[model samples]
Target chain A: MKNTFNILATIILVLSLSATVCAEGWDVPASVKKKQNPYELTKRNISSGKKIFQTTCKSCHGDPGKGNMLPLQPPPTDLGSQNFLVQTDGEIFHKIRTGKGAMPTFEKTLSDESKWMVIAYLRSLDKMKREAVVTKAVVNPEVTDVKIDIDVDSEHKKLIAELTGLKKDGKRVGLEGIELSFLVKRAFGQLDISGEEAYTNEKGQLIVQFPTDLPGDREGQANLLVKITDEDNYGPIEEKRVVSIAVPTNPKNILSERAMWGTRANAPIWIIATYVLGVIGIWGVIFLILFQLFQLSKMRVKSK
Target chain B: MTQKTSDKSRRNFLKSFGVTVGAAGVVSSFSLLGAAKAAAKEPEEMVNLLTADGQLVQVDKNQLRPTVTEPLNELQKRGREGIAGKSFVMVIDLSKCRNARKCMDACQNHHQLRADQHHINVLQMQDSEHTAPYFMPKPCQHCDNPPCTKVCPVDATFKRQDGIVLIDNERCIGCRFCIAACPYSARIFQWTEPKDSEKYKDLTYNIEANVPQKKGTVSKCLFSADRLREDKLPSCVSSCPNGVYYFGDRNEDAVTNGTTGVTVRFSKLIEENAGYTLMKELGTKPRVYYLPPKDRAFKFNGDLLNEENLH
Candidate 1:
């Protein structure tokens, strides 16, 4: 009886504590939510994980985050970039595993199968060492003219875009609506377009294309933009490139407070009216007294 | 459009009323009774026009035209009519904006934008100096959680049934409060007389018809109710040389730029990462999306400085 009472009391206490925790928000610590990097997975791992990207993560980030890159348009994330590469890979993986920010948390909905697959795909996006490029190539119908030279030693390779244009006032002026694609055909059809690349120039040349997760060949017909000039004057196609893709990643939280959102906060009309009326009332009384005194002085002067 | 509130013409209050605009108190008075004229003399309380239900409406007596401003009651009714039936939206492809004020000019011409009261302003913007520069043509975001409407003491600036936000300039008391409260910097205050062109100035004032710009009031890109009534894209959406603005009805759940007829579902587009509101953080939830400034068709240069990209 003594043993039974002790066990029953302990079970009741544990259950009550659990109930209290549930009533609260089930808060996640910032540190736990913060991304963990060293545990990042690799591309070979994520190739199998594409199914998870397709199902749970595809809604907001799209399949591979390939947004329409038309001029006067919003440029979707180039997940294939170095800035994105250096980020805590596992942190991103965890973000996909359990969403945060604008992304709905998937801890509850996703099965273990789906979560692991997302982990594999995110591992695939980490900047891989660019494969060495060979100067020589042959005509291959399967290959597009886009030339890409990946670095041999570095998993993360840098593509410096050198735009040739007339020197305007001693500065290299990047022309508008300029499209430059460099394609390098590698051995054994191992097509590598700048090793999943993204680029930005010192002189406002943002024409490089980023690979998104639609089923486009990684080897042949690589169409990466090098330079685009005054395409905004033309039409959408003139200055834009739309590559079909669908890679579901963690939400980028792009919809946060924009510049204009800051400008709209201020006072309403009733407060302003009250303030104006107060000023006017004071002035009105003052003006009335001054006018009466002036009239009295004028009459006295006339009598004198 | 829940049963399209076909302006249930109100029975003329006090039969008829005339309004004029001038500093003069007594101008061309045609009083039916001497007693009525005497009693009306110096009624200080008559300056601010109050509605039958105790809402304040500024009636510029001389400027009054024979048009009904959608009352607060009607606007509230429309708000109850959610996006379930139909909602029109515009998505601006930012990669295409050339800072060409084409949309601005179109808006001005359509709304008769006074020189001092520009409804649309194209701003040169960038996320950071490191990021590429781009031209962002700003119109009213027509926020999903509009702060302007929230702060309006009289509920003057109300969001409409068709997902457009407009002000009853007739009720706008020139407090300029709405001007401060708008996050988009979308509102424009008329400081002086509109100095409208001889032809445009003669047009009478109407709530739906944003014309005959009055002095000391606020205005902004209205999505041109006049045009929407005719089933046409807003001027800024259509006039752009670049197919940047995609306008469509949310009820239909599809958007189109006249030239690039790529129709996509609105919510789907938002989820697919092609669409987003302007300022999601402030929770204004603008209904426009931007395609980032990548390999833009128009380089961010002076060439795109036209009137078409305002939407």
Candidate 2:
């Protein structure tokens, strides 16, 4: 009777442990769940977030509600689903930062501001949240003859951008409400620093904190680019300034060593030597066999 | 007497050589030289010319129209060589490809190929019964050690320094040895005249483009050598709607995504994504690498699954 009771208790304990392991809810911290999105949900901010989602997130999660996600063992969640809508913005943000199973963690790939913008974009996708949050279209104003200037503050580690445009009567005025992007030039593309919400203030100045952890050249020189974010309104206006910041990086040369695939003149010495030896060996054997046959024929004739 | 004999002999030789200098014997022995010098001074009116039969003649310069020079020789010479200090590499991310067929269409149009012919083919591949199916876009591997170039009886098929395998159809003696040796089956023989043969007939054959594709010659992918000369991405790489292809110089160790136009370190991208080459055991050392299809979003369905499509 005691053995039967013990067995039942063991079975119940094992089952309970397995149930906890396979639980559906992600264990998000209470503080993380309450943290609100920092960026404003503007039209430009949402569009910027949309581009990021298309490039990075769409591969796995797919189009929000389409049910076209890659068929995995445990499928990726649909962002448009009611289950996702129920979760707070902080819960979703935490989930993205620390991924589970097949989903990759976005902490390294995306910046904090970029993540907030992505959340804003996701909120805009829901009709109820779109009406509540995305009420204003704070985009770049249509200003022609705009000139941009960039200055680096070494003491404060800040990048300041000043925008000025010509008025109809040839008067230069500070252009306000103009969006700008801060990017560092990389080998193949640019790395975005300024968030979607980075806009010129009433004084036509945008003061952004410079990131200290960028990879630069041997001299620790990094090319800093300040550009108008709304390219459609402003026709590719931008400025570049070189700043001494970030750690130095030495890129490895994949082709520094001699490769096997080269011109015939550059063929390896062993290959040439092997070819010569092979030719001699094959021909020598053939000649030896021919000589033996000739000797046998002479002996046969002599015997006759 | 010696000078007279030498002059007379020279006059006889000039006569035999068909010099069109009128009354050669009556003029001084240096008459041909004098006339050529006189023609050189008056370049506006007259020009000295050499005939095919070793005859020297003076012609009116006004009658001469500049003959249009053919660039075929120059094209062939440069086509055999490749861009220096650059090794091209291509990376295909199978996870992103949705079988759009836009890449295939762009390649065919760029190469002037028929609907049946393909420079790049999108194949629906299923490894096993339980495994998920995926679309694999196959092009010339452009192997470091090309079997096609080795089996060629003539030097028609060759590998360029930029890791591209090109077929000089002009030198292909209608032999299909290369086709048999290639394990990838990347090559095709122009058994019939290529599509739009008549339209491209007058075009000076560009060895890089491999068009005006001649019948009875083997033709395969050339990595868009002509486009590379202009520093543009290959047609198939540039046409992908999804960020499926990353192409760039291996020497620079960078690759740019076709869709995003973002450049990244080649080695880092390959290392992080667990990139692999096709048939690594074959020892072909293909320049093209592939990132495995991890989490594909779309259903893998194609007409290739039909019974009639099976060979």
Candidate 3:
């Protein structure tokens, strides 16, 4: 019985050791766990945190904190899970600041305030998840009323889009912290404004400098589109506005246009004149030689 | 008395001329006998010939001669003209390059060039010892005001409207004047016969493709003009894994990265990246622009030192 007990104990010890070895167990220090997050959970902090997450951590953590399943040796932790949420804010902050195994340490990269902001953002994600659940239970979620105002300043060469909306609570509010993608509807497809996703300001407005070279219709009219993409709280909303862009009267640059290296039609007058003269001179010489040869042949025949 | 002497001298010259004529007849008769003997063993086979003006004629096999002159075909004539309504441009982001040498390999393979001859070169550049090192790939600039085209006496090298500088090997006299004139050192001379297959030798010469490269002719990058005609990316641009090169029509104001398939506005990308052309002071007006090596993805490791050691 003692021998069997010894074998059983050995197997248990080996299994536990192998498990620890398989995944390098994260050891969060007691002191680190006690550390408190300093940043307040505000909308601005959450937005900046979201931006950082999208740029840096989203590649592995995915959009909603669901792990991307990238076949890592020890897979990434799902940040949105109940187990992850149960961890103290300090524990999450320590994990991000002092990375373990596959995760890289962002201590040198991110500041202390930024780390706290990320933690606040993580907490807000839990609220978003709860809100999403409550939203699904509602029979008919009222679509947010969205309005877009387009102004074309031809003198300054700027196209500005002013957006305002009414929340479901019957309150007129500026759609702050929402992404507004501005695009010019082209013949083939929509051309993105500056290839950048524009975000609305606190006043619910996004302004983009009109591209001076953007071609328009026959009447110099451009179809501009502003869209607020679908998210957890709001349904998708879009607005299209037609704006008259200034007709570009500037002439083409001389260097880019009819230069010497350009097409034959654009060849310089001097080159054409020289070419014509050279051709005529060579042909004239040839004709003159033939005429002289004919005269010499006649003269020789008379002498014979 | 002098007239009498002159008359005598003239009579003497005539007497000598008669003797020489008599000797020439004897020699001619002997040659005719030799010709008769040669004709006895001559082959009777005769070949038919078609004259250029559509006249059919027959000639002895010995009388048949090879034509020494041939005219340029349709493709060669059309090659001088550029594609209509297109102005090509290339932008290279220096921050993205890591001396992969894939562009050089692709260019060499497509051009059928030897190991020493490269149409694209990845050069290691460092402004100073204090500054960081970067890899700069140098290809033919295909300048809008190309110095190489100007010095070409035979018009062998010419620029097209679509922003490509091409070399017509048939017209190149191996003078190397364009090579001397080019500031970028982009041109290369084929000092020896190209080591190509017999099939390539039998294939018709293409001015755009520049395949079966001839000996003693100057050659440079054509921006893969033949490939451009097919609406395909240049070999170097498509082969690069780093998306260092962006090529597109300047008139359309768009440039696309061949590797990443990321299209950006030509003017905006240049403006945002602070793109600058090489040797702008020279006024060559190169179509290729370079984005400064800022915000590099990877550290400038000592790999360039290792590459230098290999060299």
Best by DockQ: 2
Off by over 4 Å in 2: A1-45, A49-145, A150-226, A232-235, A240-263, A274-304, B1-70, B150-153, B173-177, B252-254, B259-272, B302-311
- Interface root-mean-square deviation for each candidate? 19.6, 11.9, 13.8
Deviation in Å, model 1, residue A58 alpha carbon: 42
Choose the strongest candidate by lDDT.
2
Which residue pairs clash within candidate 3? none
In the range B1-311, model 1's lDDT, one tens digit per residue, is 21233233231221233222331334533443455556556453424677889999875444434666565445434333322323567777776666667887888877777544567777788678687778887788877667787666654576655667777665567888888988788998888666554766544465554566667777777776666656666788878766678777654345667444445444565666555567789877786666665556543443344443322
Show model 3 residue runs off by greater than 4 Å.
A8-191, A194-210, A213-304, B1-74, B195-197, B202-205, B305-311
TM-score of candidate 1 chain A against the true chain A: 0.27
lDDT of 2 by residue, A46-149 (tens): 87788888777889888888988878877888876767877788998998887887888776456566778888888887766667664454544445598898
> For each candidate, what's the DockQ?
0.01, 0.08, 0.03
| Residue-pair clashes per candidate | 75, 2, 0
For each of the candidates, what fraction of the native contacts does it recover? 0.00, 0.12, 0.01
User: TM-score of chain B, per candidate?
Assistant: 0.69, 0.75, 0.74
lDDT of each: 0.53, 0.77, 0.74
Higher-ranked by TM-score: 1 or 3: 3
Q: What TM-score does each of the candidates earn?
A: 0.40, 0.56, 0.57
Residue B105: error of model 1 in Å? 0.8
